[model samples]
Every structure is written in C-alpha cells, then in structure tokens.
Target: MASSLGKLSGRRVCSVALGSGLPRSRTLGPAGGRICLSALGGTGSAQIRGLGSGSGTGGVGAGGGARRAPWLVAGLAAGLAGVAAAAFHHLAPAEMVPRTEVASSVPDKADDLALRCSSFMTQPVTALSELRARPGDMKTQMELLIMETQSQVCQALAQLDRGATFAVDRWERKEGGGGISCVLQDGHIFEKAGVSVSVVHGVLSEEAEKQMRSRGKKFKTKNGQLPFCAMGVSSVIHPKNPHVPTIHFNYRYFEIEEADGTRQWWFGGGCDLTPTYLNKEDAVHFHQTLKDACDQHDPGFYPKFKKWCDDYFFIKHRGERRGIGGIFFDDLDSPSKEDIFRFVQSCARAFIPSYIPLVKKHCNDPFTPQEKHWQQLRRGRYVEFNLLYDRGTKFGLFTPGSRIESILMSMPLTARWEYMHAPSENSREAEILEVLSHPKDWVH
Candidate 1:
C-alpha cells in the first residue's frame, strides 16, 4: 500500500501527452482559401489572402541561402491564421464555423469518443460556451484529468469499505466552468468523506485584480479586466475510528491571462494526516510515503514542502499545528509546466497508498468513550483552523458562485468544544497534544 503509486491500474486510464505533436507542418485554412507551408518552399511565395491581404516569403531564399528559421515561419503562420480567424469573425460572423461543427465531419466513432470524454461540458450553455471559446484549453483539460482521478480514487476507496460509495453531484457555475462533488457520509469505515473537483473561469474585475496584486501576484491587467482559470481536486476524509486518523489532499492549477495575452500559471497542492491518537509507526509510514513521491521529483521537494505544510496548516491563534505535516506547496511555477503537472499527478496517485494501509490496520481498533471525545475535541480545532485561516476556504468563499457544500466539505461530521478540555499529563492523549504543539519530522 505504498502511496507513491506509479500508473493507475485497471481499464480506466487518464494520461496527458504534453508535447506530442510539434515541429509538424499544419495547414491554416479558412472556408475558401488555404495557406499551405509546403507551397512556401525555397524562393517560392504564396498569396496568403483570406480576411486580409498578406505576402510571405519562403523559409529558403535565393542561392538556397537560409531565410527565416523554420520555427519562426511556423510561428508567423500560426499568428497569421489567428489574426485571419479573428478578422473573419468580426467581418462575417455567420460565415465563421464553430470548431465543433467542423469536428462533426469526422467518423462517428471518433466523434462519439470525443464527445463522450467531454460529457462534463454537457448542458448549461453558458458554461459550455466558455469552454468552446478555447479548444484544447490546458486548464479545462487539467480539470477533466483531476476529476477522472477523483472518481478513480473514490472508487478505489469504496472498494475497501463495501458500504461506502460517493454520492456524485455535477454542477455548473453560471459565470464560467463547472464541477463534480462526491460525498460519502456515515460509511462503515469513514464518518464523512468528500472529494470535489472544480474548473472555474471568470473575468477578474479591477478591484479583484488589485487585491491579487496586493497579495504578490506579478501580473498587470488589460482594459481593467483579467481572465482567470482554476482547476483542482480537493478531498477530506473523517474516519469513524479515531485510531484510523483523518486525512486531507488537494491539488490545483491556476492561470491568468495577462494584458499581452500571455498566460501565467502555477500548480499547488499537498496531502496531510491528522491522527486523533498519535501512532508513531503510522505517522512515519505516512510521511515516508509522501517523501518518496517528493524524492522521485526532487530531493529538496520533501523537505521544502514538508516545512511548508507545517507552517501553512499551523493554527496561530491556538498556537498549535493542525496535525502531523505531510507536504504543501504554492505558487510553484518552477521547472516546466509539464514537469509540475507530472509531479502533481504523482502526489494525487500517492494518496491511496499513503493512507489505506493505515486505515486497514486501525479501522476496527477499539476505543474508549473518552478517546472518542478526545477525537471530537481535536475535530473542533480543525473546524477553527479552516474557518479562520485556511487559504482554500477563504478563496472559495470569495469566488463567485462557488458551491457552499463542497467548500465546507472539510468539516467533520461531529466535533465538540469542552469548557476546559485538557488531557491528563503522561497520558496518550496528552502525547498527541504535545506532538501537535511541536511538529515533528516524521520521515527522518
């Protein structure tokens, strides 16, 4: 049950090919005319006329001398095509065909498969229109990928507990994208568990953009508006048995289009464990599983993210750590977007292996009434931290049209706040509090 899983098993597979088709010639044509790169061979010229008049030289010039770089030519061709399309849309809007209609000409099976995979875009024309506006959009694609993973994770978890199955609810945001929320309540192994996937897009107003600038996002707006896309999978599991421990996992991608039409994006997420009763071996195993995933990408990742999680989840008002830290990171635009995405996928896949074995080991362990009460008290702290300090919760609340149910899904099914809740000194409960006060390097 190692959490750092490789490929997902079984028939369901979700894989992304970041840079598969490149350095290939493509015809950028409108309804009547075609601009063929092949026609622009050595010393040759093609009348690239469509929405507007333009003349382009060949990649190779006279005497077979090198003219423009192949990549540059390709880029110019793409730019020309985009400009032409926009001009055509502006001039003769009805003449411009929707890409979906063009795609409909393909074979039935291929078309069917394409539509089936994008079934999430069905209904709510407002949301679908936003998606259609950007074909093969990275944010939308990532949203679908994470939703598929969420389904797979829930399916796998439900298998472990025969009575546990997520109640799926698909929703659309009027402003932009949509999402799926899966919740399992009063299950055999878990008390309350929620797995939510959302892909939301909207125009950030000048005020919102200013707030973001204040928060240190390095981007300027165009025309007092900024387009933003956010996609993520968030989960929280509150187990029935206190010994089994509670867990949380979240992975997300955020992108904003700047004034120059360049996209600024980043990936952020992490997973952590919260055990009401501190079990040394379980804590070690959990951290080691996540550490293995981090190490696979970079030796420095585990330490950095570990410390980040420790700090981020700290309850400043209460002067305590929420739980034993696992890993957390934000604003990670380093390396390459592809590499960062791959790393996030690795962390998502690692969830089951890291927590399942621990659940299986302790799910049925006996607990006293006092211990159960202790668990409830611990849950109260979780509620406090999320309401007052969790960045995710704050953002969700601010986001227009965010589903309240999914936003508050992290709350435990039951929790209590005693007048003076203090465990006896030298007791196991007291030991947990001690560890919470002083976060430990479980892996080391």
Candidate 2:
C-alpha cells in the first residue's frame, strides 16, 4: 500500500510543483521556485495566505490595500460535513476484487478500447481532402486539414460533455500547432474547458540528431534517431456552479523501432480533478470510485496515487491549491510494450469514476449568476496558471514540430478580468470563496 501510495503521489499530487503552470495559460511564477498566489493581497512573500471563509478576490498588493485574511477552516469543516452527507447518499463502488490484479494481466499493445476511440472520431484529413477536391495546394491542404481535424475533435469533445452533463461552448485555436482546441461552458455541470490532442513526428535537426545518437538511440526501421512520429491526447475541464468544480486527464502511447525491427515502446497518461469547493463526501466518493478501478488492477494501487494526487496540485503562491487535486503522471517506461499498454488502459479506465458523479449530483442543483461569477473569477486564476506556467505548454512550444493548439487545450470557455470585482456578501459566490480561501477536504 505504501509503495502504491508513493507511486500515486509521483503520478498525481506531488507533481503540482511541476504542473502548476496550467492555470492562466501564461507563465506566472519562477520555475521550480516559490511565488505568492494567495488571494489578491498578501504579505508579498512566496507563502500563500489570507484566503477567506467567504468569497475571496482582489485586494491591493502588499503596498497598502486591505489585506485579505487566510482561508477559513470552520466554514470548510461545515461544508465538508455537508459533502460527507451528500456522499453517504450517493452510490459508491464496493470493495470487490477483480479476477486478476497481477501485473501479467497488463497488455503488451495499446488497448483495443483506446485505439477504438479513433474509429469513433472521423478522420479530418481525409474528409477535408475530399471536400476540397478542386482545391489549391499543399499549404491550403494543411490549413484545411488542421481546421477540419480541430472541428472533428471539438465535436467529439462536445458530445462527451453533453453526454456527461457538462457544457463546452467556445473554443478557438491558438494558431501554431497541428492541434484542435475545445472548451465547455455555462452548464449545470461544466463551466470552463481546455482540451486538445496532438500528433507530431519528424526528422531531427542536426543538433538534436547528435544528441540522440550520443544516447545511441536509433531511427525507425533499422536506422538512427533521425526521424520520429508521435501522438497522444491531453485535456482539462473546469465545471461551473463551484459545486461541480474541475477535472483533467490524458492518455498516450509512443514508440521507436530500428531498421532491424528491434523496438522500444512506452505508455503514458493520467486522469485527475480539481474542485474549488471541497466536499469530503464528494472527495471520498470520487476517490473511492477511482480506488475501485485501481483495486481491480491492484488493491495496493489506491493509497499510493491518492496521496500523490493530494500532494501534487498545491499552488504554493497562495498557500492553497487549484482544487482538491486528482492524479497526474507522465513518461511511463514499461517493462514490456504490453505492460505499458495495460498501464495506459488502467489509467483510462479510471476517468469515468473520477468525474461522472460530480456532474450528475450537481448539474441539476440551483445556482445563481452571482455564484457563477465567482466560478468565472476562479476560472481566471485557472487561466493564469495554465498560460503562465504549465510545463506541458512550455515543452510543446519549445519542442520542434510541436502543435501549439493541442498544447493549450486546457483553457476555460469564459473567464473574467475585472479591475476590481468580487461576489456579493452572504451569496453563494461567497460560499465558494469560503472554500478557495481556505482549502478543505469534502470527503474527510
């Protein structure tokens, strides 16, 4: 259990120091260093402080504005109690064990189910080519291909949201990568969404090729690491109505084989959620659902990643976190291609349990515009983190042949930037503020 817990931590929570860059879509803090993210005004130090028991927002900087107070714990405790009540009433998976938890059950290739997702999605390149029968040239073809592919991806994501009770409305490409961006908005469930998947591969530049050869890495088909091709999915979802919160997940497979048919394969992916308002009952429900899936594969797995998820998403700047975090991991070097594939499959299997209930339970709950405004404001912070500091965005941008649109797929549909705005006193928005200002565990 401890080993699994540690791995889960490495996969999810502790990594927030690595993933905190996702919120604003812009880099905000110093890399691998502390910066302040406390509610509006704070002590002008790296420590996150002064979040409140009520809706917390803008305040003057350390210069002279009214200082915001640290988050409220009692309020959180009360809310957590409510959440526990909610979870007690909801359905939760049992402690049943699967027929096999041994690593041997892990598959050697990409799971048929995941590869099948491609089939559900219409291939845009072909559809565009056919539509442009009398078209111009390669550049036009590439442009049309990218646009059409994005459209398809957008539609697919919308369908997923609609089916799950989330709303994803506006999404525009950031223009640069062979990626399609999408967002979910203004729904009983989801509020903001950022999701995109990219496929990139090419011949390495001389400098890059030198680095590859130095590692003795070879190219495809009995050659050198001169050329390569890759693909994968990545995404983030922010729900509206604070009660519904946010979530993120991704799954991918990569490979390299030499001319002699010798090949190396790997699998990488993860799924997690961030709820601004902590509901321990909800957290337990969410965690337990994920735990069931992990147990199906290995009962020992749950404790590891659960703690990891908790530890990872901390926004040290604020002395708080983006939300009650889920799980995160990358670059899985598997013992065998099959094992790598199974690992990817196992992670993918956990997504439904992680988020479905949040939407079902809260989508129909009544919420006011004022409360939504608070959610949007929080979404703004999310935007800040993603744009300013997300490592994935940095990696995709700096890496040659990276698709920018896909790299930035984790953005919200609607966000606010008020010179100085906040929720009304004693409002639902205030309720949300109470949670964000001071972090709470709903399930606990």
Candidate 3:
C-alpha cells in the first residue's frame, strides 16, 4: 500500500509541476494565506500559512498548491478516510462491509450495478481516499468508474477475440501514488491494447506554479509545494485486422489544495476512433452511441464535447483529424459534482457499446498486404499524434517516477512511415483522408 501511494503521488499529480522548487515552511509564516488544518478528529488548534489561490482550469498545475489552515485537516482527513474505506472494502468480506461504509451511495440501480462491477476490481488507496473523504467526491468516483469501465471493456473485447487477455502490471511511486497498467499484445484480434488506471498525489514546486500561471492556470500560493491529487483511466486499442479501426479512451479527475484549504477539482476525458477504412454506418454508430450517452446527461454535452474532440486531436502538422471525432471535454466542474461524475460514468460505460460491435463486425474481414500496409501507415500517423501533440503523453513523460513502458504502451505494436506517401485519388483511403481533413458530423 505504501508503495502504491508513492507511485500514485507522482503519476498525474506531479506531471503538471513543471517545477520551480518547494518553499520552506518558515517563509509561509502567519503573514501569508491563513488556513486552519484542524478539521479532522480535533487534531489541534493552529493556523497554517501558505501561498497561492486554488482556482485553475485544471489540465496543468491542477494538483499543486498549499493548504494552510483547518481546511487542510478536512481535506487530509477526507483523503485518509477514503483510503481507509477502500482498504476495508477490499479486505473485508462483502457481508461484513456496511453499506454506509461504501465510497458512493447512489440510489440508482444502474449506479449500483456499476459499483458492483468496480467492487470486483482492486483500487489504489489514494483513489479510495477521495471516496472516504466525500462520498460524492467527483474526482475519486470518476476514477473508480473509469477503472471499472476499463476492466469491463477489456474483458468483453478479450471474450470476443478468444484466447486474448490483458497482462496486468501494478507499479508504485515513492512520493505518494500508484496505478495498474493492463496490456494485451499480439492477440487474436488486436495487435496491441493498453488500459491503465492511476491515482497519484504530490506537491508542485514554486517553479511549477509559475509555469502553470504562465499557461493560464489561476491560483496563488505563498511558500512550500502545492498539494494535488489525480486519478484516471487511459487506453488505446490496435486491431490485427486492418479492416478494424483503432480506438482510444481517457477519463480523469484532478484536484488541488487552495491557499484557503479549499479543494478545487475538475473532470476531463474523451473517446475517439481511427479507421483505416471509413464505413459510414460504423462512424454513425460510434458517434450516435456517444451522443446517446451525453444526451442522457445533457443534450448540449454531445455537441460541445464533439467539437472539442475534433479540435483537440487534430494533427496540426499534417492538417488532418486524428480520426472521426467522438467526444472530448475538460475543466468540467459545473451542474453539480454528482451530475458531472454521473455524466463521466455514462461516457465511460458507452465505450464498449460504441466500439465492441464494430470490432466484431470487421475483425474477421479479409485484408490484402496492400490494405495492411495502409493500416501501418495510418498507425504511424497515430504515433505522431501521441508522441508530439497528446497532452497526456507530454505530461506522463514529464511526471516523476513515470514508467516509460506504460507511458508508451499506447504505441502501435507495428507502424511504418513512408516518405511522401499518398493514397490514390478517389480511392477508399483517400476518401477517409478527405473526411479527416474536414471532420463531418456523423450524428447531429
């Protein structure tokens, strides 16, 4: 557990730290921001001082900041309680586990089923701390939900493919958090597949805070490293059959301690499809499923997130879309935390329905060497997008104690780049390129 906590601390939490240095506590004397760190179990009476306000969009510098007062105790207590609850939930027998001790207490049957699915899987302690602290904690709940979704999606895919199962890797960071990385290589249907779930916490150094400010993050801090917590699930699937398209999904929650000891949090994630061949029906099904999920939560969500997806995944250098867009959203902390968490859950659950059927539809289809070559070429472009422009990749590379293998697990098992290669005019590949060049609405 200690090892996992350390790994989780650095995963996503420290990635945003573009670090400057931690301020010594003395510099944060009573003159700085005043915070009360005495909310949990009446630890003591004292005023804590630190620098920085905790308001930011949350993609960068999301979890680094100081908490100087009693509120600090509240946040820490919540986190510790969450972790304890998670440990108990995992170690205790089901009949012995009290309902009140559960991380979330939603009344919906659907939510219950989702929780059951999650209960069967293991979660890092840090991930549980958020839940114990606040039953409705959006960040922790989303992480749990996403982790379950990853398990279910990968399991379903494995069942369909036959004789393919993901090998799980559990790793930890010395500072404060850990994660599980699941990968399937040279499978019956997929060439490579990676699904990862991480929970991390860490402090952002002064330099990191300044860098975040430059990037438009809104926060103020006095001295000492800012504290942060991040959790999420990320995955990419590459099929063996060229006819089958590639898919990617990422869902995450982030939180940071404010100078006032208040916690600032947000949710971000999306799913997109990349096909070697464009099938109008497949594209329609994928987009429609995502739309349905969003509609169930907010009718406006689909359109907004759809546009964000198109804009975010674009390969600016090549002037092409990464794939037919699905839905992407970030910095979301509105319409109530519970609602947004449910919304994220809906999106996470939508993945299998949106993608698996397509895989089943095309997995056995015959493909010639020429088509396979095209697929590899397309994969090369996928690599380009990830290594160059993907924010998650950049952050992972920068994060402390990052496992390079897991970070690069999204890379294709095999990809080929050709100099000045172009598909034949009016051909199937060319048609796909045209659509990518100008993303179209598969569902409106």
Best candidate, lDDT-wise? 3
Which sections of candidate 1 miss by over 4 Å? 1-137, 205-211
TM-score per model over all chains: 0.71, 0.52, 0.72
**Local accuracy of candidate 1 as per-residue lDDT tens digits, 381-431:** 999988888777756655566455556678787899988778899999989
Candidate 1 lDDT: 0.62
For all candidates in order, the CA lDDT equals 0.62, 0.41, 0.63
The alpha-carbon deviation from the true structure for residue 397 of candidate 1, after best TM-score superposition, in angstroms, is 1.2
Looking at model 2, report the run of 10 residues with the lowest lDDT sum: 6-15
lDDT of 2 by residue, 187-220 (tens): 2234344444344344434554454455465555
Query: How much lDDT does candidate 2 score?
Result: 0.41
Q: What is the lDDT of residue 328 in candidate 1?
A: 95
